[model samples]
Target: MKPPPFSYHRAGSGEHAVALLSALGPRAKVLAGGQSLLPMLNLRLADPPHLVDIGRAEDLRILRRAGDRLVIGAATTQSEVEYSSLTAAVPLLAEAVGYVAHPPIRHRGTVVGSMAHAAAVAELPCVALVLDARFTVLGADGVRTVAAGDFFLGPFRTAVGPGELVAEVALPIAAPGTGQAWSEFSLRRGNFPVAGAGVSLTLHHGRVAAVAIGLSGVADRPVRVPSAERILLGAVPDDELITRAAAAATEDLEPRPAADPAAHILPVPVAPVPGFDYRARVARSQVRRALTTALARAGGTR
Candidate 1:
């Protein structure tokens, strides 16, 4: 399939890209990695009249540490984030990036693009939620920051308005005693996961001091399981506690309609969404598995 007829506009920098967007209004689409945008265009899922290319945006290629946050530019590919020294700061993101399809895709897909293109069914957005990542948006109105929780509205949807483009994503550095783990259910590596979990846990004195649970393929968007986190806080992570927490995680899953669960991704299809009971069961199990691994990494027993 081919994309709809469109006018191509090239921007030399991030600011230039924003200016183009302002002029084109919502009819223009910004092109960075083009991994997701091109596919959507080919499928006619996105029919914008203008394509604003930002590939030449040098300032938007930044990857650096701004104090405690590891900042990644909109043009920063997944490969760059995966291999960069800055990855050490957000281990969960680093670990999850490996599960984002194959190296070839990673080499071309921008981390911010994936975050903007995806909801909960993909990897980066889920990791964004778990790490409390922040997105910087630039527009004619000026700049504004959006938290991951508020940024992800749904699949291929985000807080970025028509004239605003996401310039960068910033992730908080993991504190001492923090341990991260990622898990996904797929018949093969690089395939869209049937379900997945990303966990960040901090243990102190054998008890959970802090934890964040990010779940994918369980709902319309990547989400944090606060109820599950509450179950583990200040408690020794054991078989019993983990079991209880995992069950709590299930309470938060709102499965897609039974008739067409795959419709959540629209032009793209994911693993068939299972029955409500099955999804709840898988969510519980994955949370248990991730928490167990995270606890071990945090130097906790069981």
Candidate 2:
């Protein structure tokens, strides 16, 4: 497939990129690592009139820690974030990054690009949701912060305006006794998960303290299962409790079977509209696996 013709510009700085985008308006698109966008271009899914390449914008390639929070420049690559010293402080994010595609893909894929791409099926964004990460966006009106929960509005879509560029992401330091686990189930190695969960919990006085469960590939957006989190709060981890939590986590998903009528002959669940009911079932299974792993890491039931 060939992409539609477009003008190209390489920005010297983040500010320059923003200005160019602002001036170009709706016809312009920003290029980071070209991991996701380039594919769209190849398929003619996106035919923007101009392409602004910010790959050489040095400021967006750095990672730093500011006071109590860790700041990641939007253009920072997945490989950089995975091996960063600061990311080591946040084990969940680090582990998740290690699992993001293969090494080759990670080398060229930028973290901010993935977030801005807003693929509902991605894992890191779900972790971002669990950690309450905040995104910094630069626009003509200056800068503003948007919470991860609010930033991702739908599949491959975000709250970023026409000219706004995501500058960085801010994550708060985890409280003491806090542990996190990220796990997923994929049909093949290195493939995106069919369903996944990121669990963060704080242990207080020998009891469940705070819990945040973020799920992916089970809905239109990364969903936080508050009901399941609430169940684990102040309670002990047990088989029955985990089961109940898994159900809660998948309660809203409606997994349907495959669309091809002939696919039903494969002896697998199939349904319409992604089979929300059946997807929820698969989601339930994965949630249980994730919760068990998370509990074990948190020292297993007090």
Candidate 3:
């Protein structure tokens, strides 16, 4: 089905987009790459009265390093990031973006758009959360920075207000001696993951000094599992320790039934295996895989 009738305005600049959003309020939606939004619009899942196209907003296409952080503009396409040298600054992000979708889709999908879409299983948000990224949002009241942890409220929900637009996202460059990895389980290439994990670790004197673990497709939002991190801090990187940390990652999660049995969008089309238990298991495995990979990269013995 075609999208509902709506007026389209190509924003001349970031300021113009903000103005349009403020004036249109809840009725207007900002269109970046439109990879996610277009699907929703086509499905009639979203029906806004107006669309402010910010794809041409040059200011929002920035990709640069500021101090110790890599700042990405909301309009920067995933493909731009994937091929940029800046990806080396955040390896986890680079690895995760590869799993977002096919090359064609990535060419048109914006990283900020994925975060703003707030999909529970989206790779970018999980990576952002693990890296403690910050999102800058613009509104009529000016700008406000929201931590990645607090930016996502739930599936398809975020701190972005009706009239506010996410202007940029800032991810801290991994400190020296830090290692990061991203792992996920999907039915096939270019499909949404069933469960995924991103891990960043720093080793000090043969022990885990600092670690961060973020999970996707296992909760209402992308989540950093402090419990799991706590289990690995100051510990030796070993199979036993990694196993315990992986278990901690999913120990407290409550499993829920799958949404639809008839939908083939996911690998498992039945509730029998796609329920909470299944996701938890996948989450555990991914956490283990990510941690192991990160540990190896950090020069720790597996």
Candidate 4:
């Protein structure tokens, strides 16, 4: 189905886009790559009065290092992230981008768009949360920063207010001896994970120092497994520790309900758990795998 009637304006710059959105209020939608918003519009889930296109905004497409962090502009495409030299500097981003929808979609989808879309099961947000990334937002007032923890509020929701557009994502450079791992349970390649895990550990000597774990596809939002993180810290990364952490990660996640959607009706999709029991089980399994992989990378003994 075609989207509802709307006015479109190609913005000259980030400030120009923000001005349009502020004037239009909540009735306006900012179009970056038209990846997430277009699909929602076509489905009549969103019917904005106007679209402020910022695809040509040069400042929103650049990637560079700022001080000790990697600053990536909002309109930067997923393909850029997948192939970035920054990913080599920090492989967590590369691993997360690998799990995004296939090449063509990635080529057209913007990183900031995905984060702003705020899908609970999306790989990028989970990775960002695990990395404790910062999100930069542009508004009528000025630019402001929001931590990953505060930015993601719920499925398809964020803390961004009207007239605000994401400007960039900032990732801190990992300290020496830091190790990261990402894992998911997708039925097929390119589909979102049924349940996914992102794990990062800082090692001191042979023990875990600080640990962060983010869970997806199992909650209203990507949730940080704080209990599991505590369990992993200062502990020897052994089978026992990994097992305990995995158990803690899946202990209370209630699987979401699923409708047997007709394949023809909903062509785009993500990993869906078979049932409540199965989803919980898969969450546990993914946690185990992710933590184990991260521990190994951190040079922990088997």
All candidates: TM-score: 0.94, 0.90, 0.95, 0.93
Q: Please give the RMSD to the true structure for each candidate, in Å.
A: 1.8, 4.5, 2.7, 2.9
If both were scored by TM-score, which would come out higher, candidate 3 or candidate 4? 3
User: lDDT tens digits, residues 125-178, model 3?
Assistant: 889899999999999899899999899897778899888899999999988778
Q: What's the TM for model 3?
A: 0.95
lDDT of model 4 at residue 181?
82
Alpha-carbon shift of residue 161 in model 1 (angstroms): 0.4
What is the C-alpha lDDT profile of model 2 across 42-136, one tens digit per residue?
Answer: 76777899989888899888788887788888778999999888897676788788777789888888888878877666788888898999999
Candidate 4 lDDT by residue in tens digits, 1-61: 8999999998888889999999888879889888788887898878899999988898889
Clashing pairs in 1: 120-222
Model 4 worst lDDT window (10 residues): 259-268
Prediction 2 global C-alpha lDDT: 0.78
User: Which portions of model 4 show Cα errors greater than 4 Å?
Assistant: 254-256, 259-273
Candidate 3 deviates by what RMSD?
2.7
Greater lDDT among 1 and 4 belongs to 1
- For candidate 1, write residues 133-208 as lDDT tens digits: 9999999999999999899887667889898899999999988898888887765899666678889999888888
| Full-model lDDT for every candidate | 0.83, 0.78, 0.87, 0.80
- Which has the greatest lDDT? 3
